[model samples]
Target: MSNWSIDAGVICFSGVLDRFTVPDLWASLSSWKPTEKGYLVDLSRVERVDSAGMVMLIHLLEHAKTENCHIMLSFVPKDLGTLFRLSNVDKLLAKHIQN
Candidate 1:
């Protein structure tokens, strides 16, 4: 199971972002508007992900960029960091790098 929460400039998520998790992603994305500042998604709680989850994040990034907003990922696990590196999004998201 997976869940998420969002407030003006931040979006926090914990759980899987796989095929079954797309709905959560959509719900989060659709909540944003062009006028919004941006997003900082906390993926530290998410234990796992599949391609669908990656796609969801990519789409959110596209939306954020097109809207002239920034999207960040916080506390990414090591395994997922590798995935982000392979996907060429290492610097784009987890620029915060607190952990």
Candidate 2:
């Protein structure tokens, strides 16, 4: 199972982020509106991630764009970073990722 919390304009995620978990998380966040112009997404505690998780991250970025907000992802897992590079999507998300 996976879960997320927001504090001080940062969204922190923990546990596994896969196909099963992404659906519920996505549903919950779909209607969320950001109150800040800039936000940070901290994934350092996330144990694992799959393609679905990557897709969800992209969707979150798009959602933020629609709201005229910007979200930077921080502490991305090594494996997920590899997946992004292998999938050739690293460039697309590079500007939004913070090492």
Candidate 3:
């Protein structure tokens, strides 16, 4: 049901997070100012995550921390979740990339 949608603090990424990904996420994330404790990461669209993509997200995470904002990813696709887990990146990843 959720393919692409956004609110003030939520980005419903509902397709794929591979290759030319994360930039869109960056745009959406930069669309507004951080005015609260947390935001959201709708990875429902993110189907695959490569190293480059992960790097971008990690940068976002670091920036978020310095800014004192947060992102919570919900409903990540099954395969990507496995990929994330397999890469052992789940530990270093911030809280937003989880359900």
Candidate 4:
């Protein structure tokens, strides 16, 4: 199962990220209004991810870009990092990645 929360303007995600959980997450984030200088997406607690989850992240990145919102990805897991690198999205998401 996957869960998400917005705390102090940061979007926090926990649990496995798979096809079943991607849509709801997308919906929730799509409706978000940025009150801070930038938006932060925290994925450290996310235990797993499938292809669908990766696609969802890419789409979310595009959405944020179109909205002119600066969104950063923080605490990304090693596995996800490898996936992104292999898919060639790491460079595109480079500026947004935070260790």
The clash count for each model shown is 0, 0, 4, 0
Clashing residue pairs found in predicted model 4: none
N/CA/C clash count, model 2:
0
RMSD of 4: 1.5
lDDT of each model, Cα atoms only? 0.74, 0.95, 0.64, 0.83
TM-score per prediction, in order, is 0.73, 0.97, 0.65, 0.87
TM-score of 2: 0.97
Give stretches of model 1 more than 4 Å off: 88-99
- For model 2, what is the alpha-carbon lDDT of residue 30? 93
Q: Give RMSD to native, each candidate.
A: 2.8, 0.6, 3.7, 1.5
- Ten-residue stretch with the least lDDT total in model 4: 29-38
Residue pair clashes in candidate 3: 13-45, 14-45, 15-45, 73-96
State which candidate, 1 or 3, has the greater lDDT.
Answer: 1
For model 2, how does the per-residue alpha-carbon lDDT over 34-87 read when each residue is reduced to its tens digit? 999989999999999999999999999999999999999999999899989989
TM-score comparison, 1 vs 3, better candidate: 1
Q: Candidate 3, residues 1-99: lDDT per residue as tens digits?
A: 113565777766555555576666666655545676787766656656666555656666677777888877677666656666878887766456665
Off by over 4 Å in 3: 1-5, 22-32
Q: Which ten residues in a row have the lowest lDDT in candidate 1?
A: 90-99
Worst-scoring 10-residue span by lDDT in model 2: 78-87
Query: Largest lDDT belongs to which candidate?
Result: 2
